[model samples]
Target: MKLECQEKHSEIRNGEIHVYAWFFNRNVYENNTNVITFNKIKSERSGKYTCVARNKAGFDSDAVNIIVTYPPIVWTKDITFNGINRPRIIKCNVSGVPNTYNITWRHYTNNNQLVRVFNNRINGVLILPEGETNDLVFEDSGVYRCNVTNGIPDESGNLWQSKKIQVKVEGKPVLAKPLKSTFIGHFNETSSISLFVLSSSNVTQAEWKAAENRNSLGHGCCSSTVNKTSFNGKCLDMSGYTCVFLIKNTREEDFQNYTVDLINKNGRNTFDISLISSGVPEVPSITDIYQRQNYIVLEWKPTFDGGAPQGFIVQYRKKKDKNWESIRIQSNETNDFVYISKLKPDTEYELRMLAFNRLGNSSFTVQFTTLFKGETKDVWTQFNLFLCIPIVLPVCLFVFLLWYRKVLHDGIVTMTKVWLLDTISIFLVTEMTYIPR
Candidate 1:
């Protein structure tokens, strides 16, 4: 049965139009009580209406009522993609009514392309007792979405509901695990050590640390990551140096370390000295003092640091200057020296060099210096004979003399005289016994 709104012309008529109704399904109908209803109606039929007609009753009147019609909105777009070469669900929603509708699937690609996809109708009204849910899966791991709408509407009639969603996919790294290290040569006997690194990417940092025997020689090598997998460690063993080695990849954010200490011994010493590369500055030594020159050219023995060093840094200042001046030079090995030539001839300059590493530059380092013609004020401050004799030697000698006099002085005198008498008797006997020509 269906109930429809209608217009009435006279007053004394059936209570209302009973065109169609589920409530009026009763077989028996009262004399003038006609009511009708419909399970559904055309959305266009929404509006005011009046029922009319009169039978044996005077003029007919009408009562106006409205048929409310709300339709489900329609949507056409759906589907999207992600950056990882993967698919993902796009955030989307559509406005509509009846809340009960058939949701059809369709795909609208981001490239301004379209494709129609199909899934059986989703009768949320039948599926869910209350609300509706639209869940979608990635089609072949690419991208997709669903279109939703009811079969009818208020104005145009059929409507649609739809939204787009994206899907994603990603792959794993090439190497599954960390690389294992290989131990190279004789640990303690190597005069100089070298390190070689081979990697899948450019290395930014490289350095070595050692600890073994009783003394460990810290690195004195330039630290860098040339990363060829196989390169010289270029480690110089200091005197009495023995230790384990630890290689590091400073290029990495967290940095990866290849530690050999586990196979070696547990030591507290870390030989982390930076080596001088070719052209790199060495410990500065000045020679041939010149009185006429205000500043002296200081040279340092170049370093044979492991990696290529961009250059050397030299710092100096007049003995009276408030600040210091610095100079840089490019280098590649140890034993090379730099002659800082330009200077104020009369002024004394205190010079030093700082070594830079992946960790940062070494502090105001004294590894290098320029020889300066020192003022004669205290030429022998360290070798002052007066200081030793008056302060140290005298005090020590006085102590020894007192100890000697108090302890063995008497015994020494007696023993000496006795020995002298024996010598004299022997001489007398010799004279008496032999008259030689």
Candidate 2:
């Protein structure tokens, strides 16, 4: 294929004439001649081609569109439609040159017989039951094939392209197996438990209730209706035939065996699930510590709540003091940091942090020295130094000086001197160690 642009004469004159340049789809064609040639072209090369003649005064250009034609390609996928009572529309996706085409729909039956369902110029066909208002039946389930042709033949000389779709029509309500039957939740937290049902028709009525006892009832529950709006829990309609029982705020009493009853015209079914309590929360870790004026701000990252709603408790005390000051945070609070105000500057204080729920609590402890009123360095650095000194110094002194001091002093004064030198070296090394900011 080739494209050529001829120069046309005009009365207006330019300073100097230049060579012609060629372009395809707004991109420069490597060939700078007036004609663009292709030994063999594919569909991708079809687009607008332009030729431009330039001079010192200005430039002029012209363009022409190119198109490639191909045979029809039909695409289809298997579809499963629940609620057989409803009408459905089945369609095949087709793409090719010449938008106009004829579509043929055929069904392959269980007896190995081929039957033509529809033959028309439309892309899609509506499927209904035998009667105008009748419901679809299981006999409607089969392999439906769609053939499309636009009067164009492929390279292999095949005029029609075909695709098949497996249609399934189901009936009766049955339990859709759940991944797990038990859910762990915390008190005062929100939880949604889902129960899926597969049926040919919509679930006209659904009942969500708590069982008096799970051990006594094997399939059904004695109704302590939790689906009412007045209660803490309610039934929510979900897509894909799922019934969700949402507890807005779970309580200790809400942790029990639950049942979901699904009812349609054809049949009814029930499913059971259990909501259990979680254990104590994991220990909290201090993520950051800084000082502002006389106030110390401590930030911590909360750990897993063991499937329950949890809150934080911060306790702090002066290093020389025995009693601790406590600050409790509620679960609904969003603040991740606690501000300890009116603290003595340049004084070391021990801090204890714990996460607690109704179940129990876990705690972590650290020590930080407050910064001076106008100090810029953070309390985190001081905390790091304090952590090393208090822990290492006491343990080292107790093991080396207290336990072996008498023996060395009675017989080997040189050994005692060496031990004292080692202890001093250890203390200096610890003090010089890098402190976390």
Candidate 3:
């Protein structure tokens, strides 16, 4: 704390100035006569301090109060445990000089949300200057922060240690996701089987056993025993427990369900994996399309069922458009045609056909086109014009001659008379030439 001169007038005005300062009713200083200062301030420096200035005119006085605040210090190390059957306690170990700060516990969830843990309990989270988590799970593993704040106000004050805590809880082995009842794999193709275990557990050995028929390859082909890691960026093992199985070449005899057995003193957990063939169905093609007043009918044919029951799917859209409308065939239906009603008139649409089964879908997409009622009428009119052109042209010329029959008869009579005169002249010349010869 510091105090300044409080004299009412300077000594230059012929009035001598003197100042006095003291902690209210505590200590006083007269030799300084103008200002008071402290080398260091602490909790003890709190309370009121008074200042007085004297002159020939009289005296003036003023007072001020000082207060100090500090945050609590905490440890930065992580709190860890081997396993939990009951509650586990973790202390914050915070210290404040005057014991003038409050303790608050915070739990950071897996989804990155902060929840206040107070009053010694909230679900699995408990708070009392220490954090206690009961029946911990893999989701409970995250950052925990212990915050402290004194009632005092200071701009430059702070805690002396780190506030973040990393908590790790170990427990029994549990699957991240349940295995499927059946999986599809191609013949003679490589396949992968992955299993994830949460944290560290009592299970020490993980083994895979093939069906009785495939006993020739004993112990099955399992590889890449990942410890404290994840597979394909999923099933992250925070406690280092994961196993993977890889088959180089699948065979028909290996189509049975394989069992994975995990053994330890605690007990044993087993899961079976069934494999099936993923054969693709044959491609389907659209054969015919008929347009009516309010709807269009489409027909398609599929060649083979690909060793399984097949279903057809029809998709269509406007010509040169980006969006498409789809129709799924029913599983019980055995026919190959579908009626698509409620269509716009005079519009052009492109259709696609394909077939699928439980194994896989066909590799090809058959494309076709459908014409609306007005568009079909335009096609028929063009065909009629071509068929009538030969017959109509000759009839049209005959009609024109009948409208001008008199002019046509006069011209024909004149041409016939001229031809007869020319013939006569040619005959006379020919007879004269033969006589001269």
Candidate 4:
């Protein structure tokens, strides 16, 4: 609690000093007119108060002796995770001073999301569920923590503890068919990726990444992964795109490989790309790149130019790996809308696509990040400028200054003398005339 002093003063030479004081706690007034009466009360508000009085000579007395107190700790009585209904009870030790302590619980959601459950206190402890001591119950489950604190009554004031509770959320991952790989000549064509995700768990995220510059000697561009919400997964680059994923209902029997082949569509075309993706489709020749939300838009020109395509499919895989896993992404956009979007941030991805026509399908792939942010390079612009002055120039100046000091100490000298010899002997005839003068 805190008190704020508000006093007005006036003087008039009256008889004796008469002091009047009043205290307020919102409407209800208190007659604590005693000059030095105060207690160490635990309140929500405490501040200074005013006392007014006239002296014998009509001088007024000022307010004095303000008091301040600390507020009591807030006690939480219940713990709720995500929602109101309790799912399963978690067994844990329930130990705390029920008289002063309060407990609150935060529950994890079925989809790995965190939510706080609220409840009004019944007894002291957050009304534990059925049988267990501190029988914490949860609807959805995961790792959860509890906040227990001994509020105001705990005179020592330091009373808060959090205990982590691990939950065994019962569920499995759902999965879709893995994509097939493509090959060009003996050099190995770039691989592509495609898939859908469904799960007992909330599989709300998809990702794809590949090793970079992996020739035979191998840099680091061989492995990548993909994640998506039960639909077209991250579009991969044919250049380097291989990875796996597990969704809600994934089981032990699901670990396997999927493969696809590339067949030339139009024999007359130099590189015929047949929609070989699926069903009724001919080969495509030219490919186009476009962008779309969370995916790369890939379309190819029909094998027979001007012919409408049934549909377009993009393919990709991680670079330089034996497994050579593949995934294919589908697109509804026309051949013109070839842009791909929502690739992994700061990643290198390759892409290829097959266009379906009356004859067959044509396939082509390339590599680039879906993100427009170009790769960053090691730039020394700012640091280089600083080093030139503070480090380079100063060191050079010190060297030159030392060299000059050495030259000064070495002591090299040059001198000149004045003397008249043979030229003055010829002028001796002037000596006699000068003596006479």
TM agreement with the true structure for every prediction: 0.21, 0.36, 0.42, 0.22
On TM-score, the candidate that comes out on top is: 3
Clash number by candidate, in order = 88, 2, 1, 90
Show where candidate 3 strays beyond 4 Å. Answer: 1-38, 42-68, 81-136, 150-162, 177-182, 201-204, 210-241, 263-269, 280-314, 317-437
Local accuracy of candidate 1 as per-residue lDDT tens digits, 19-94: 4212122233223334555466554444444444444433343444444446554443332322132223233344
Ranking by lDDT: 2, 3, 1, 4
Candidate 4 lDDT over 190-309, as tens digits, reads 223333322223333333222232112111221323432211122221111232322223333222232222111111101111111223344454445544445555555544332233
Q: Model 3: how far is 120 from its true place, Å?
A: 13
Candidate 2 lDDT over residue span 1-437, tens digit each: 88886657655466545678878899988876777777886667778888897777878899999887777878777777655456676778888777778888887643334534677847555464354222233335567888888888888999998888887665655543223578786668787675555455577766776777533322322221222111001122212355666776888888888876677776666667799878888888888887776677899988888777899988888888999898999999988999887677677777778899878887565655443354456678777576876566666666665545575567656866777767775775575563444
Candidate 4 ranges with C-alpha deviation above 4 Å? 1-87, 100-102, 108-141, 153-160, 170-437
Off by over 4 Å in 1: 1-295, 302-310, 333-335, 367-437
TM-score of 1: 0.21
Q: Compose the digit string of candidate 3's lDDT tens values, residues 248-324.
A: 69878756777776654545556666766667788887778887557788887778676567888888888879988
Off by over 4 Å in 2: 8-19, 25-31, 39-41, 55-58, 110-112, 125-135, 173-437
RMSD of each: 31.6, 21.3, 19.5, 24.3
Candidate 1 colliding pairs, count: 88
